[model samples]
Target chain A: MKHNFGAGPCILPKEVFQEASQAVIEFNNTGLSILEISHRSKEFEQVVIEAEALVRELLHVPENYSVLFLQGGASQQFAMVPMNLLPEGGKAAYLDTGVWASKAAKEASKLGNVEIVASSSDKNYTYIPQGFSVPSDAAYFHFTSNNTIYGTEIFEKPAVGIPTVVDMSSDILSRVINVADYDLIYAGAQKNMGPAGVTLVIVKNELFGKSGRTVPTIFDYQAHAKAGSMYNTPPVYSIYVSMLNLRWLKAKGGVEVIEQENIIKARTLYDEIDRNPFFKGTANVEDRSRMNITFVMDTPEQEAAFLNLAKERGLVGIKGHRSVGGFRASVYNALTISSINALVDTMREFEEKTK
Target chain B: MKHNFGAGPCILPKEVFQEASQAVIEFNNTGLSILEISHRSKEFEQVVIEAEALVRELLHVPENYSVLFLQGGASQQFAMVPMNLLPEGGKAAYLDTGVWASKAAKEASKLGNVEIVASSSDKNYTYIPQGFSVPSDAAYFHFTSNNTIYGTEIFEKPAVGIPTVVDMSSDILSRVINVADYDLIYAGAQKNMGPAGVTLVIVKNELFGKSGRTVPTIFDYQAHAKAGSMYNTPPVYSIYVSMLNLRWLKAKGGVEVIEQENIIKARTLYDEIDRNPFFKGTANVEDRSRMNITFVMDTPEQEAAFLNLAKERGLVGIKGHRSVGGFRASVYNALTISSINALVDTMREFEEKTK
Candidate 1:
């Protein structure tokens, strides 16, 4: 058994994997591999419907919102959000929390005027910026809710008077959020949802066509909503596997139940970091992420030694982003408390060895 | 034994499915689900490299062309082709063979001026238009190589003298093609390549960054090519499975061997359609697609009865598109000669029952 702490394209339930794997061979006893079935077929149409419904239920998304399963990841959404929301010559306010946040602002700037309301870039994005006001005249306020690389997250949706859009790619479905608070929420479903193909977009229906730009039909949210996320052939197997994982999430008592487990998991690992002498947490204490827990050692040699030990014990994907050297154990919703214990045990083992 | 005749998201080799399903559970003995591994990992980096290499080997793609595994299907490419190739105020010429072809032109029209050099819509797109002159001044000439819905195909690349782009969504790897002739060739992997979610783009390196328009980074071909399709986390499992399918294709003696099989399979089915008194082929004989074979009965009742008979014989997804209002048997590369014989035998059984 391995404890996978990879950030994005990360772990899902073993049950989900078993079922998903089975479907690749024979889907629903339909005498067809899920990979080969037509996206237009009733069976696949139901997969999309159920996946959408699960998102709505898990997040408590309002009826006015459209849940879309799209492609191209959050990188595509960076451009699409601006294209669909920022009108010609309109300005959009952005809070740059990390690389992803900065990229979002940069992409938006290409379409129209963009104002960086706040940025944590000065300190290598170690914390989410605070006490910054979003420009009221801006068409929309955009921010990254979770910074996977920097090990920081903005838990509270900023009370900006303008429409709010958040990139929840790393932390979506791991915790609860009020869907009504944001005009749009987009996430690449690799982190907590399922895998690395489909993107989840939950946008308020009223926000449609507000940009007044000739958005490509494929990029337009309204076109996807009107067509029920079947504007064209969607990532069929990805969406289908996502549906299976969503079903798994729903069975595990939905997001509320998972949120409490996530809190415990983060706290357990963070407690070990605080208690251990050889290791140190990187993010500011107040803004430390509950998903990706970044940490480092006093020396590169020590860090490498710990990583080797972690590997010997079946701990994989704990290496940190190059921008923030050391280790990042991404403990998403699917990661169990036992895995947290295993990591804590390893950290203690490292301390004992060092002593 | 089910013979899937779905137009797209169609069949792949049984061996590919077996290997793909196993990888999902435990990818390459890594003790991690394929769905969970980090895209930045060396393991997955190898998957992308091998997939690209296999494509180059199978298609005999020149070193000057970059093979990209992208998302959002060919629909996204319809816009990206224009965004990347058609300069601001420049004109692109298009050949309208069916819905997909027209849609491609329509998307391009939004980005720059598009000229419909020719269209076969006069005969309900039953035939491919010939003797059309493409404007020499156009930035690019775009056409759909295979019309899945209309059951028509253009096997030859028309000499247009401009940057030629073809959407070979349905017939890409079923036969050999000169990659040097076309400036850009894209195909949704569902038909002849792999499954849905991932799209294959073989673009000449010289065509990059010539649009003179500020294309979104995600939509820009140069960005994708430079990053080696790792511009963002690609559809991981989709690409992995495609690699498996491509490996299967290579092991089965590459495109040359499969082309012969496809030819024999198509001829066997088309022969049955021609000989059967109760059925008639829909598309023009000269332009009939080797991949998607469309045909119809004289009456709706007869068509319905034949469809029922086909389903009973474990032949699925043979029902044609509503636009064509007939039966469309999509015999992709993975579809065996036995499947063709089964479809033909079913057609003969229908004729005998009717008599």
Candidate 2:
């Protein structure tokens, strides 16, 4: 079996895939493919309801918060967050962790004034910037909780007095979060959630329409919340598959259970990286992501040789981002311990061959 | 045999469904579900490229145009169209035919000045308004090619002096059209194209970046076209299935062949509607949509009775919009003429029993 270690749009449970695949042929015995059913139909309405309920139950999202399943990835959210939160001429504060974080800030700057609260760019984003003070006068504070490219994660939410927005695209659902902490949280549902078409948003209801700007109805969070995320024909099949994946998560004892397993999985692989002479971890020791584990070798030839060996042993998608030129084994929620063991074994084999 | 006539996310070919279902489990023998594959992978890149190529081939799109597979459906396009085409303080003309048409105008009004060139709302949008003069000074003239709810269609493009844009969400690919006639042609894939998560946009290359307003990068057509619709993670499975559906259309002799079948299918059903004494067509005869045929009975009791009979005959989603309050049979590309016959037969059966 192939061990998939791809970052975002990553692996999902086998059972979830099977059930989703079956629905594509005939959904809930409705005599219609899930792809063909009307989003407004009672059957599909149930799918959306259950998907929302699953998000609520698993995350313990507060009742005051609205959970939306929207189209356009987190990239779209970059613009939308600023449009709905930052009023005309208002300033927003942002922390630069990596590419995604800086991109978020740049989009916000196009709409209004933005102050870079802190940045880890000095070290090539090898760690999350700490002790940054968000301006109290700013409309809202925005940051990326997990930097997929840099393989770093913020375990603790920054307590900024103003509203806080976080892009949790790569690490959401792999670990539990107190949903009440952040005023708004959005993630493109490709990694720990489900697939790519849909983005998940959990926002405090009170935050809706607070900005004086005349946001386009489609981009307005209040419109979506009032309409129950059926603002228009949502990413139907994407939402359905996400519901299936969520069901699988619930069956496996929710995010808390998954988080424990994730810790062990990351530790097992990182231990090997530290112990192996030919390999080295890329990110800071404390900030190293439990989701995407980035690493490298002393020589380019050694890295190339290990990648070839890993491929021969059925490892897939371990190649790192071009910015960080080695390997990134993304161990998401659906990645089994067996897969991690397979990678560790491959690394050991490489070391023995090198010696 | 269930004959689905849901407006959208509507029916697709059984073969396309089978292949799409298989790919969800194991895409292209890569040991990864299409749902799980990275959008950046060569495998999925090929899926996007092939989908774009198929659109170009089937639509006869010129080299001067770009075919984009995007998320957020036509609703997102409602905003993007204006954002990309209408410059700051520029006036745009719109034809108000139905709910979607009016909604498009409403969204454009948020961005800039929008003038209603013509409106059929006076008669509950039963006919496409004709012989209306578009404002020559307007940046663009927008209209709905087919009104799904009102059962009306504008078969010929109005030669408005300015740029022309059409929302072909319900009828795109059911017939052949000259792509160069309109500056932009967009369709939510659910109806005739593919599924709900993705939307198809065929836009002229030169039209990009004309809007002087700082359109958000995500909403900008030029950014999407430059990146080949890969500026962000796309609706992967939706694009894949659409490619499969397009392949089916090509093998069945392309849009020209489908158009003939669609004409005959519509004619056969309209013939029954006119011939039958119990049922009466709703839309103006000359403007009745080939995609959705709306009709009603004299009494509410008669309509309810006919609906029950229709349901028992294995017909689904034939119920009309709540506003229309009768029946609407949406016969999209994948809907076989045999299914149309089933609907016609059901209508005939109702007449025989009532008589």
RMSD to truth, every model: 0.8, 0.8
Off by over 4 Å in 2: none
| Tens digit per residue, CA lDDT, model 2, B1-355 | 8999999889999999999999989999898899888989999999899989999999999999999988888989989998898999999999999999999999999999999989999999999988999889999999999999989998999887889999999999999999999999999999988988899999999998888788778998989999999999988988999999999999999999999999999999999999999988999999999999999999999989998998999999999998898999999988898999999988888888889
Compared to the true structure, candidate 2 yields what TM-score?
A: 0.99
Q: Give the Cα error of residue B132 in candidate 1, in Å.
A: 0.7
How well is each residue in A1-355 modelled by candidate 2, as lDDT tens digits? 8899999788999999999999999999898899889999999999999999999999999999999999999999999998998999999999999998999999889999999999999999999888889999999999998889889999999888888999999998999899988999999999999988999999999988877777778899999988888999988988999999999999999999999999999999999999999899999999999999999999999988999999999999999999888999999999999999999999999999889
TM-score of each: 0.99, 0.99
| Chain A of model 1 scored by TM-score | 0.99
Where does candidate 1 stray beyond 4 Å?
A: none
Error of 1 at B52 (Å): 0.5
For residue A197, what is the lDDT in candidate 1?
96
lDDT of 1 at A218: 95
Please provide, for model 1 over A1-355, each residue's C-alpha lDDT reduced to its tens digit, 9 standing for 90 to 100: 8999888789999999999999999999899999988899999999999999999999999999999999999999999999999999999999999888989999988899999999988899998888999888999999999999999989999899999999999999999999999999999999999899999999999999999999779999999999999999999988988899899899999999999999999999999899899989999999999999999999999998999999998898899999999999999988889999989999999888889
